[model samples]
Target chain A: MKVLVPVKRVIDYNVKVRVKADGSGVDLANVKMSMNPFDEIAVEEAIRLKEKGVADEVVAVSIGVKQSQETLRTALAMGADRAILVIAADDVHQDIEPLAVAKILKAVIDEEAPGLVIAGKQAIDNDMNATGQMLSALLGWSQATFASEVNVDGDSAVVTREVDGGLQTIKVKMPAIITADLRLNEPRYASLPNIMKAKKKPLDEKTAADYGVDVSPRLSVVKTTEPAERAAGIKVGSVDELVAKLKAEVL
Target chain B: MAVLLLAEVMGDDLSVDSTAKALTAAAQLGDVTVLVAGGNAAAAAAEAAKLTGASAVIAVSDASLANGLAEPLAALVVSMAGDFEHIVAPSTATGKNVMPRVAALLDVMVISDVMTIVDGDTFERPIYAGNAIQTVKSADAKKVMTIRTAGFDAAGEGGSAAVSDGAAADNPGLSEWVEDKVEESDRPDLTSAKIVVSGGRGVGSEENFAIIEKLADKLGAAVGASRAAVDSGYAPNDWQVGQTGKVVAPELYIAVGISGAIQHLAGMKDSKIIVAINKDEEAPIFQVADYGLVADLFDAVPELEGKLG
Candidate 1:
């Protein structure tokens, strides 16, 4: 079965994000960009499925301006067979919401018709858990989100969802959408040989308009402002005073 | 413009805080409707109706929904979507699971964990965990969202409304409900607790976490831990609080032995009053702490307990 894994390029998780001084958005000029933390898990899971012979081919896809190609390359390095860069990866000005991205992805779904699709539960930057479900809806496919474990049988796959209290397992047919949770698996580091191999691997680039998707911003940004800054607090001298103060304040 | 608030019920009872918080968020839109999904949700639906400004309560009672499974609940919301323009829910795991499915089915945009409802079409959500705040506007005809429970006040009780029954949703893709391995502790729920006492690698060993538990039990607080502690096997994964873990905003957050890494801060910095107790005064957690006590937690914790005694 072919597996399609969607990856995203976002500000590195370790880097301290600074809002633009002009208050337009985040300052991404010189900031280091990396594959989204959760997307790494998605790619890693897809690669493991191929390694274990659960999937025949693993294709990685990314929707962003030109810089996103680098992330797709990272996915290839990790173990994806090839990559698809939707829209110029380098277009710094191109910003599309999850719904629009899903629209573009639906076109890829129609073209490739992969049996399984894996995505991160949510993106760290937008934190919107929409694309995967939207893709499932657009394609009318069964979806198992926040998947911690997955075992594929002949034509059906059993998935374990990470819920609030514990875990819930569900069985779904092929041609399904499965999202990766944090505990799904530990992502492996790409070796030097794999990185070199990824460079030679195929990367197909396409425009959002090619799929009849309008990458227009529907939501208006009337104004951007920071949250209220927390006030300065008191410093306690001793445990006794701390206990008394905490009791007086919180208890 | 009517807003639909999906209320998650715990057993036969309505999650009062979650219901109230969702209602408060729905109030930002024009009219409000609370849809309670569970078994015997009559009491919960009635209570939901008593909330000061709620417009109506629609109870979808089913033995299957009692577990709060995502697919069936999503189907229920989808079946009832035609009446409302905006759909809202608490940013709990269940809400997070169901909202995206509903939004996807409706071919609309979903804004998760919104801290402030700016207008009918716009909202403010925390980005990079809770460090940077991003305000987004959904241009879709139907808007779906998850409200941060800590961001809004509960809708006041005593308003009058009738509770109506809803049709059972047909979900062909739902997962089965098995046994839940809940951490049975007398402590309160971490996200909703007013006081939270968390530990980190500085707690040293798994046994050392007993100090945090003792403190939490004494104060009726929830016990939380840093990823380091959870990774070190000092605590359970559910207790982990960081950018990748649970996001919490207790009234009083006490960090013991935690150095306050940016990831860890992203989870609890929204806390109202923070107290940091660590040997290293330069710990990043002290930067955000309302009260900083420079001392070895090994000694400070026991002393504080004695003082409480």
Candidate 2:
């Protein structure tokens, strides 16, 4: 069985994002970019599945600009057999939405026919958290989202999902979709040797038009503004003073 | 516009507080018709009917919906989509799982975790982990959204809306419900709790988390933890409060020993009153705190507990 892992290049998690002064969007001109943390977990899970012999081949696909090939190369270093980059037009790249990404993935799935697709539950940039479910709906396939644990057994996979209340375990058949959560696994760093070898891995390039996807955003960002800031208050000298302030002001 | 509000139900009863808040959000759009879909949903439907904003309740009881597997639940919602111009649910895990599918099937975009309604088709939501707020306008004929219950007040119980039976669609039979391992806690839920006490990596070990629980118990608050604490195994994942975890806007939030990573602040910065207790006066958490106390939490927490006692 083949496993398809979709990775995204996003602003590094540690960087504090600033909104552009023009209110267009976030300022991402020279920010450090890396594979989304959750997608790294997804790639790790797919690589582990391949290592365990449950998956015969691992294919990493990314939908973004030309720079996204670097993300796919990182995935190859992690152990994906090949990579595919669906290059988006410059205008489309600025406003790519989850629905459009899902449409493109659906087209890719039609061609690859991977038994399972693993994706991050949410991207740190948009935080849409909709691609996997949208792909599942578009394909009429089963979906087990927010998966913290996944154990593939023959044609069925038992997934432990993190829900609002607690943990829920469900069994989903193969040819399904799974979105990786935070606690899924710790991703491995690409060794220098592996990074060098990833350069030789075959990478196929395509475009949004090739998939017959419009790549147009349905939701328009009317405005972007910094959230209201909370001003710092005076520090209390002692526990008694803190309690007094809490009683007098807060509680 | 007619609105369909998905009810979050546990067992035979509704999650009243969450559903009530969802109803309040739905009321902002139009008249609400609550959909209670689950294995034993009659009681939940009755409870939803009591919410002030609901005009009607549709109870759908199906064994397949008992666990809310996404396939069947999405199918059920899509089957009933024609009657409503808008579909809304609380931004819980179930809503997050199912609403996108409904939106996709309807060929519309989902505006997620909506903090405010700007109209029938526009919403304001947090982006970049609450660092920025974006006002989004959707031109889709049908609007699908998930409301953060923390941003809305729960509708009171006084209505006597009529409850009617709703039809269930065919189960895809592609997934099976195994079991749920829920953490049984007597304390209030983290999101709805009026007061929350959170610990961070400075708490040191799992044993030291007891101090957090003790302080929380004293104040009748829910215990929360930063991702560092959860990742370190000092607390469970469910107790995590951050961008990736649960977002809470409680009346009082106390951060103990937390350096206030931006991700952690994204979850509770909306809180009405925030207090920070950390040995490091320069911790970023102090920036958003309403009151700052530069002291060792190990000493401050115990002293605060004793004074409260």
Candidate 3:
């Protein structure tokens, strides 16, 4: 079985994002960028499957602007056999909607025919947890989402999902799509030697037009604004004062 | 425009509060038709019919719908796609898993975690995990969305909508339910709780985490944990409150020993009255807290719990 993992490039999670002053969108000029943390978990899981001898090859694919090449290189360094980059947008600020990205991925899946596809549950930038499920719907395959643990046996994958009430486990057939959650695994940092070898790995490039899928924005941004800041609070001296104040105001 | 709301069903009954919250958002657009799909369809539909702003209920029942799997639920919503102008569900785990597939089958994009209904075609939703809010206008004729339950109030009772039977979509049988090990807790649900008491890494160890729960029990509040605490294995996954976990906006949120990272702040900053109890004077949680107490959690938590008595 071959595992196909899709990664995304997004603003590093540590940086505090700022909204553009003009209410257009987030300020993205010169901000540090990296593979989405959740996507990094997906790539790590795919590589682990290969290391376990449960899969033959791990192919990593990314969809976005040309700068996404760096994200794919990181995945290659982490142990993906090769990488595919689909340049759907030119501007770094333009985020391709999940619908269009899923369509283009469907076109790619038709060509690769990988048995399993793993993707990030959501990107930190848009926080849209839709693409993996959209791809599953378009392909008529099974989907296991928000997965924290994924185990593969003969032809089935048992996935443990983090849900509202508690943990829920499900068994999905092979050739399915799995989306990684935060607790999935801790991804490893690429060693200097592995980073150098990743340069020799093949990195194939394509365009949305190459797959005949139109990547267009479905939702137009009317405005963007910073969330309202909380007002400065006063410090309470002791537990007695804290309880008294809370009871007077809240209870 | 007519709105179709996918009800969140738990076992035999509808999760009334969450479904009602989504109803409030749906009512903003147009008349709502609540779609109740699960094992005990009639029971959930009966509850859905009582929600305010609900004009009708479509009850879809099937054995395969017992466990919340995306394939059959997505197919069920797709089957009814032709009748409604907009399709929405609560942005819960099950809803998030299924709605995007429905939107994809209909060839439209999903506007997730919507915060406000600016107009019929425009909405404000949080992006970058609540750091930035984006208002958007949909170009698609049929809008598919998931309601962020935190953004709206629960609909009142006093509505008598008609309950109609809807056909359950055929199960694709691609996935099967294993068992759900749900933490049986007597406390109120986290999102709907009026008062919440959360612990942080400062609580130190799993055994020491009991003081946070004792305080929650005394106040009849739900128990919560910061990502720091949850990652440290001091609390269950469901107890986590943060950007990647659950978003909560209770009447009062008391943080015990939580330093409050930006991710954790995104979840509870909207709370009406916030209180932070941490030893660190410069903890980020203090900035958003209505009342900040600089003290050791081990000593402070016990003192607070006893004082509440």
Query: What C-alpha lDDT, on a 0 to 100 scale, does residue B309 get in candidate 1?
Result: 46
Estimate, for each residue in A3-24, the C-alpha lDDT of model 1 and write its tens digit.
9999999877767767775666
Worst 10 residues of 2 chain B by lDDT: B183-192
What CAPRI-style quality would you assign to candidate 3? medium
Error of 2 at A1 (Å): 1.2
Instruction: Quantify how close model 1 is to the true structure by its C-alpha RMSD in Å.
Output: 2.6
Give Cα distance to truth, residue A128, candidate 3, Å.
1.3
* Candidate 3 structure quality by residue, lDDT tens digits, B1-309: 899999998877899988999999999999899999998699889989998899999998998887878999999999998978899999999899999999999999999999899998899999988889999999998999999998899999989999999887888889998988775788988977899999999998889889899999999999999988987989976688887667789999999989988879877888999999999999989999999999998898889888885
> Candidate 1 DockQ category?
acceptable
Among the numbered candidates, top DockQ falls to: 3
DockQ of 2: 0.71
The digit string of per-residue lDDT tens for model 3 on A63-149 reads 999999999999999999999999999899999999999999999999999999999999889998999999999999999998999
lDDT of 2 by residue, B1-309 (tens): 899999998767799988899899999899899999999899889888999989999999999999888999999999999989999989989999999999999999888889899998889998877888889999889999898887899999999999999889999898999999875887888977899999999999999999999999999999999989998999987788988777789989999989999779888999999999999999999888888999989999999888874
For model 1, how does the per-residue alpha-carbon lDDT over B1-309 read when each residue is reduced to its tens digit? 898999867778877887787788889887998898886778888888898778888988887687776667888899999989999998877888778778877877788888888888888887777666878787889888999877789888989988898877876653555444454667877776888999999999999999999888878899999988988989987788887777788888999999988779888988988999999988888888999999999999887766774
